[model samples]
Target: AQSVSQHNHHVILSEAASLELGCNYSYGGTVNLFWYVQYPGQHLQLLLKYFSGDPLVKGIKGFEAEFIKSKFSFNLRKPSVQWSDTAEYFCAVIYSSASKIIFGSGTRLSIRP
Candidate 1:
C-alpha cells in the first residue's frame, strides 16, 4: 500500500534558526511529492513540490526539499526561520495523476521569538 509518513509530530525553533522536517513515502512507481503548510487559522499552502526533472526543488518563503527516489524520502529544509514560520507542515504523495493524495501526519512547527 502507498503511504506517507512524517517523522516529526512537532518541532520547535528559534527565530533565525535552521529547520528540517523528515518525510518518507512508500510507493511502487513514479509519484508526485508535495510539502504543504497550514498557518494558524489559514488554509494549507504549497511549500514545495517535485514531479520530475530536478531532484531538488525550491518553494515559497525560502523553503526547499530534495526528492531521493531510491530512499523514498522528500525532506523539507529552511536555512533560516522566523516567528511567522510557525505552522503545520504536511508531506503528501500522489501515486498517479488522478489518485488521491496521501498525507502524512502533520508536523507542527513552533517558532519562538
Candidate 2:
C-alpha cells in the first residue's frame, strides 16, 4: 500500500514571500505523484505531477517541485507568493497498480497581505 505525508498541516506566509511545502510518499512500485491546491472556497486544481522522465517538474502560479526518487520526496516551491496563494494544499500518491490514492491531511496556507 502507498501512503502520503505532508510535513506541515498549516502554513502562514506574507504576500510576495517565498513558499515551499514538503511532500513525501511511501510505495514499493512505480508511482504517480501530484500536488493539488484549493483556494478559499474553491475547488482543487493540479499544482504539478511526476509520472516519468525528468525528476524536477514545474507547475502553475510560479510554483515548482522536485521529485527525488531516493528521498521519495516531492517538495513544492515558489519563489514569490501572492495573497491569492492562500489556500489548502494536498499531496497525493498513486501506484501503478493501485486503484485509489493516498492523500495528506492537507496544508492550509494563510497569506498575509
The candidate maximizing lDDT is: 1
Query: For each candidate, what TM-score against the reference?
Result: 0.96, 0.94
| CA shift of 107, model 2, Å | 0.6
Who wins the TM-score comparison? 1
- Clashes within 3 Å, all models in order: 0, 0
Backbone steric clashes in candidate 2, count: 0
